[model samples]
Target chain A: MDITINRGDFVGLLGPSGSGKTTLIKTILGATDVYGGEVRVEGQSIAERRPRVGYVPQLETIDWNFPVTVEQVVTMGRVRRGWWYPWQRREDRLVAHEMMSRLGIADFAARHVRELSGGQKQRALLARALVSSPRLLLLDEPTSGVDIKTRDEIMHLLDELNHQDVTVIMTTHEINAVAAHLPWVVCLNGGIVDSGPPADVFTPDTLRRTYNADILVTEYMGMKLVAESPHFFGRNERGSADSSERGEHVHAASV
Target chain B: MFTPLQYEFFVRALIVATLVGGLCGLIGVYVVLRRMSYIGHGLSHAIFGGAVASYVLSVNFFLGASVWGFVSALLINLATRKRSISADAAIGIVTTSSFALGVALISRFRSFTRSFDAALFGNILGITQADVIAIAAVALLAAAALFVGYKYLLFTTFEPEVARFYGVPAGWTDAGFSLLLAAVIVVSLQVLGVTMIAAAIVIPPVVARLLTDEFARMLLLSVVIGALCGLGGLYMSFYLDISSGASVVLFSAAVFLIALSYTTLRSRLGSARWRRRSAASGKLEPFH
Candidate 1:
């Protein structure tokens, strides 16, 4: 709940379901009312410069069968900066085409968006987000339902964008994936329970505190991973966890 | 067609049909795509109150209907803005109450010459030159709005949340769309009638959707289908001595059925061909 994301930072938000991850994002978008504080960007209120933030929503937010071409969908991102007319200008179309080609979706520019696969759809959304050249990009579960290969490709694309000085803030449930790749991670459950490098925060104590369940955490190739505690299978009572059992759980939780 | 054009009434009817058909069809693309087809029914009924009020006040029917239609649309939007009332519920409450108010006013105004039957069912032959000009002008305005606001409309229709995030002026676009929808419904009420106007607003675009996946092509096809249905239906009604509205709706239905059958057959045949090719190539069929 209390954090500062510096410019050009790539932060991955990790939380369990109903842990206010989405609510936090919505508050950042100024879509939800914040009673006690203000959300500011570059010392200005978020409302004053909201257009500088690009958002790639979850796939379910779009209508796949909508009667629009991929090029048209991407062209929509230019609304804030493009010509006042509804039709995109020649140069605008060229810009959109270039962005699509960069995203590797130029081949399907004329095709209906419904014809796209899951990764292609995400890329198309990403293309739309980048068409406006925002300073910060926010995504809601970009890797949900995608294959591992596509997820890695999307993460690499985000990292590449970050290298270009475009900040990225994404909410993801993939603990190990974010742990392995992202430099900053924040675990949230109603509030920020832990925040630091993945190696420091993704331990048994933080996982249990954030998830409210016994979990096993391990590391491979210097990247941490988390799984549900095996003792959780039979031990439904929290009172039954003895001190020795808790110690064993932590040992198993962190490798 | 040649014989019908000789008479002034038939000519007026044909001109009106062409204009109304094209207008409804063009607007119907948005209606069907956004799944807001109920606006046609709701606004047509809401405009009836305005027509009856026109009769009582001796005002121009178009002026009264346009005002009432626009106000009713805004009211529906207002009710929906708070999220306290569902869109359909708002439409139902506002439109049905306006319609009931019209009936009540009509019952009180015994001196008014315009009959309720004419308002509810429409009279194609009753169109005058002034009516034709008004309809033509409003249709032109609607067309122009769509032409200039295509991207905003498409964005809002497909993804309003994202559109708003990028400062797409979602509020203005929605208000403009609601006003346009109201105008189309009110104008078509004279030809398609209050009850059947929604069909004209829905059928053509749906048929076009069956034929193409592209939006621009679908818009063109919907207009073509609408204009053809109007001309063919009006002519058939003249020859067969039937209700022109009913004839037009039936013609649209027949066209829809044909498009449906063609689309179904094409997809089936396409899949069968794919399956045969896969078998010939010794490839396993992927489980859907």
Candidate 2:
């Protein structure tokens, strides 16, 4: 897929499980090798320029049992600065403090990271990624396990960061969370099934092609949402409501 | 304390202990944080075969052990990456196989000297000035590696995926860390020997964790605690006529227990004071 992310755009990668959303984001961050296509950030190939890319990985991937404080966690973003000095400058610490406060996690700065709630931990991770002040921010499944309120809060935080002109590119299973807020959307399953605005790409035909399951797309409160039918074989009908309530249900059905 | 020759040995032992202890404490922070403590045990024991091979060939023991350690480290890294075997299983495999190899090598040498026993249990009194210099060099290199890779190391230790995403080269970080650990193992073999060196690497950091929440401060405290254990162990060996290596380990364990108890008591007292203050202000809430 050939796509360009501008300096201040908030782009959401929307796709089902096993889709190549993560691969696309990883390619852009230069974490995954690109075989044929090119991923350019700020008119330069990521492989050539090696631009600063702040990444917030899915929280479930972290081992919370590892003992570390919130401040120490946030300070990890500045690791690429230099080798001889390990200490963060006063300005770095101040910026971390500001980021923590911005994320509403200032009270938990001195607390052990394992003691944080799910939302708080997500915010802490986001704060850590933001401390480096990268030109581009890439997040993988940022709201995968979060509740609806927390998911909206996280998206709002990203929106605020985007307002500050930090380019945001996030891959998430939570399509409804981005349908109303994100400026651009890419729906992919192994390859780009469709790419455009959320309203344009989140169609019944696109959803069916992406997930290989019969899905129904409906409009709720001026927003597009996917609903998988109970008659569909192998589809967990019970999970749809729970997932939809969490704003993460993306339904695609095979004919 | 008064004899010149005895004092020279004592000073040499002190220098060796400090160098080994300080480096172990410093690097042990990363090991403990990364939850790779078993790697210490695995590498220390695996180097025994190399030590025995050196003895058989009449070569420098440090060089032999380092070669063995590097090989074992590389093998462990490769096996863990390539095969589906868990880290503990890899450690078990390398340590037992190498230890058995060392034992078999020792059995082949029929001279039946006390040097083999010394290598197993370690004899701090036998520490030479040359050993002290070698230990210092190893410690210096370990310190330099830690200093240069401190941030990346911290990043990898805490959030490896995120570190990789930021282009921190997690693979190289792990390899560099493993190499540093092998170096520590080789140097520590002088005083801690093949069998007991893992304790020297572990106990101080475990004890230091009780005293501080900050990583940097914890490192400093561990080093101090390790140095004291080494010095006190030597003193105990001289005065009470105990095994120096065992005495050192015992001193460190004792420090760990004391620190644990002290921290527990302090926290209890502090919580009690907070409760009393809150109760006096009529703002105390009932415990759930």
Candidate 3:
């Protein structure tokens, strides 16, 4: 909890549901109260610094029926800079167009938001959040419900952003996909259970403690992966007795 | 067949309707886009109580209604934020109670007169020169505020949390927006009456959405459509001897229906064209 994130660190918050991972990020972004501890970005408390913090919320939080185009959505980032006119500045428009093109959504710039696929929508929102040239980026479950390919694409995009020295702090349940990319990790279940490199914090003990179940860990390609035993919760009594009817045992293996 | 003296009222009604209708059209674009139509409706009805109270106290009805409407708006906003109540439920509570109180107070005064009917149903025929000036000023102020706060308002409407992270105080914007909506509702009530104001505030923007995707175009188109509806309804009322308020709302609804049908037809044709192009490109295949 007392650790410091440097100016360009790519950090991943790894935890199960009900953890304080989101609370920690919200506090860092000054969206929540930070009474006992201080959150500083570049030698200034977040409350005083007012750095541009780009936030990507969970996709389920938005009302998809909202009437907006992809380009218009991205231009919303400039709203705080006193550009309220419908016709935006040439520079802002250029930035927005470039961001959309970089995100591979240039063709969708004129399309209504509701017509977008899930991956397209996520990329559009990502472009929207990044168009203002924010120094710090926070993403909450950006890969949730997305296909594996899309998830990797989004992570790759974030990795590229991180390479450009933009600070990134993201939360995700997909530990292995992030372990290879993220340099620092914070594992939390109601509090900071562990914080260190992903390999050190994503052990079987940490996973079990975080998820409240017996977990098996395997190391492959210098990354820690977790698998939960289905019998940890016991079997049902009133169900079909056949092995096939026992419901395929759930096991998650990640690298 | 129209005499000059009688035609003056018609001309005045057309001008006043165009001014007020255009203002509502511009503001209603935001109202519908933000899903704040219920707030608009609530403010409109709550202002009724204020107008009634002012009437009973022999005060300026507009002043009473604007103050009361703003207070009611603030209370509704606070209740929605501070408590667990839903916004629709809160608005329903505030508007119904305030309007009922207004009706009760109005009942205690002298016998209900034709003026009460005129106030409830709207009387474009009796609008004074001062009324015209006041409506024009309110309309201009609303247009200017909308022009200045357009982007911030859109940002807040679509993604409030993101707007807040970028240093836009979304809550303050909401309060300011509610105050502006109150002003719109007050002016609309004076012109169209409370029972008919929601139609004027809702239909034009809904129609505009079918016509365009650009926000500026939507605003401009909605204003034109609303003014046209207002003027056309006024003329129809003058000639056909119908209720002016009802005629205006009906004309707006008619326009909305026509626009909806047109958009649907256009989209279908666009999709057909896309299908033909894709087929020619050998991208279309039959599903088994």
Top candidate, metric DockQ: 1
Per-prediction TM-score to the true structure, in the order listed: 0.90, 0.82, 0.87
Every model's DockQ, to 2 decimals?
A: 0.44, 0.30, 0.37
- Least well predicted 10-residue stretch by lDDT in candidate 2 chain B: B1-10
Q: Write the per-residue lDDT of candidate 2 for residues B140-175, one digit (tens) a residue.
A: 788777777777888898876568766687989988
Better of 2 and 3 by lDDT: 3
Worst 10 residues of 1 chain B by lDDT: B114-123
User: Over the stretch A121-231, how does candidate 2's per-residue lDDT look in tens digits?
Assistant: 898889988988887898888887788888889998888889888988988776665554577888788888888777777788988888787778888876778774556
lDDT score, residue A12, model 3?
Answer: 88
Please give the lDDT score at residue B260 for candidate 1. Answer: 97
Query: Candidate 1 — what's its lDDT?
Result: 0.84
lDDT of 3 by residue, A79-177 (tens): 666455455677787888999898899988888887788888889878878987888898888888788898889999998999999999989888766
Off by over 4 Å in 3: A1-3, A33-38, A43-51, A82-86, A228-255, B1-6, B109-114, B268-288
Interface RMSD values for the candidates, listed in order?
2.4, 3.0, 3.8
Candidate 1 lDDT by residue in tens digits, A1-255: 578999999998888999987788777887776788778877788766664678899998888998889998898888766546767777778889999998889999999999889999999999998988888899999999789898998999999999999999999988876544789988999899999888899888998899998778887787787764545455546557555654544344211
Q: What local lDDT score does residue A37 receive in model 1, on the 0 to 100 scale? A: 70
Report lDDT per candidate.
0.84, 0.79, 0.79
